[model samples]
Target: MQATNQSASAKPLSIRINRVLYGAFVLLSLYFFLNGSYQDAASNLGLALIFDPFNQMVRWENRPRWQRAWLLVHLLVMAGIGLVYWKTFSA
Candidate 1:
């Protein structure tokens, strides 16, 4: 138990806060999307991106193909969601 506590406390405060916010934003985005609020989902997703959830800390050229693909797919999906929201509500 003491080891676990020490490990938990080892992380910097900002990183902990970021992890919590990242989770919250991702869940919020999902909630909004499921309830037919595409605009809200897209906006929340954009906010989540600011937290860099994909974590490209590794050098881009050295990263595995799947990592690159996942990030690319995520960005594409975000763009798709924004386009959908725009089309649905635009005048």
Candidate 2:
């Protein structure tokens, strides 16, 4: 019984930890972007996507259609920035 209670409590704690890590990744991506580290920014964004493709923190799926479209546009812009940086610097 004690073990069952402990396991049940652990589930929410694990989810919270995952959300916190996801938030950190998003913040780090922004930091990299601001500092002109496009490659790293893109990498962090990729990690975030892997962790939370639907953008749960932002409740992206619950938002209206236009907002969802804007989120896609934002991701594309980030990808473009990284691509341009790679092309310019990878000679």
Candidate 3:
């Protein structure tokens, strides 16, 4: 009974710790994104480009394979930016 009460009491503290850790990770990633030098941007951009669909057309296509691939690439880029943005505002 006492052990259960003690364990339950510790849950909030554990949650708080997790929150702090996540916040720190976000801030660090943002710092890398924003304060990162031109070389950093170039590297990340190059990495992003690798996933781009070279055969994709901007207009309508018979199949969505290229479109879907392009969308996935953009989504990843946006996610990266969002992480940085979230950190920029969180601070």
Candidate 4:
């Protein structure tokens, strides 16, 4: 019984940690986006989506059809930006 209680308590703590990390990733993504670092922003956003803090942000089931499709759109846009940058700047 004591072990069960400890396990239950630990679950919420882990969830809270995940939420904090997800929030940090989301903020980092926004910062990168504002600075025109599309690749980094997309990477961080993808991480946040994968971590899925609280299941409240970036969840496919919680979103409308268009919003769910936006994930792929976002990735494609970022890839295009990266390709442009590489072609323009790479040796």
Candidate 5:
């Protein structure tokens, strides 16, 4: 009985987290795809290099779960910075 209630409560939380993760993935993918063609646009090389140490810290199955949280924060911060860069230069 208690187990059943716990499972029911967890389901909604999991679903909400999953939806946010999917949304972030789609947004990041779109940002990369649309901006990838330009040489002047920010390159993935820098990101890969910067985050390499964190990447190496995780085991395979658990990596995605951890990276998703890391990336969601990263995207929010970087997107804000990127927007500022764009606004500063493109003017």
Candidate 6:
């Protein structure tokens, strides 16, 4: 009975909520970026990374192909955006 209760209260629902929150952060980031709010966009991007919607905690070699690609692309995009913003505004 205790095991059943713990299992019933476990992560499935929280995982779903995290995914939703992650998506919202990404969308909000995009919105800020497009609207010329670089600081807010970058902030949201950091928040999204904290949420780690893609669950990239697994070892690099242990992660499947799509997971690796997702995390890599995310980091690359963030870097690219930061570079562009810095170059454009930090003269």
Q: Quote each prediction's TM-score.
A: 0.57, 0.53, 0.41, 0.60, 0.40, 0.62
- Model 1, TM vs. native: 0.57
Instruction: Tell me the tens digit of each residue's lDDT in model 5 across 1-91.
Output: 9999998888667666655655554455457758764322233422432333343435646777766666566566557657878999999
What TM-score does candidate 3 reach? 0.41
CA lDDT of 83 in candidate 2?
84
Better of 3 and 6 by lDDT: 6
Q: Write the per-residue lDDT of candidate 4 for residues 55-77, one digit (tens) a residue.
A: 34345677778656755655675
Mind sharing the TM-score for model 6? Answer: 0.62
Each candidate structure's count of clashing pairs: 0, 0, 0, 0, 0, 0
Write model 2 residue lDDT over 1-91, tens digit each, in one string.
9999998888777677777877888899999999999778877866764444343445756777985874575578667767887999998
Q: What are the RMSD figures for all models against the true structure?
A: 6.5, 5.4, 16.3, 5.1, 9.2, 4.1
Pitting candidate 3 against candidate 6, the one with the higher TM-score is 6
* lDDT agreement of model 1 with the native: 0.75
Candidate 6: how many backbone clashes?
0
Report how far off residue 33 is in candidate 3 (Å). 0.6
Off by over 4 Å in 5: 37-91
Considering only N, C-alpha and C atoms within 3 Å, which residue pairs clash in candidate 2?
A: none
lDDT accuracy of residue 34 in candidate 3: 88
Candidate number with the higher TM-score (1 or 4):
4
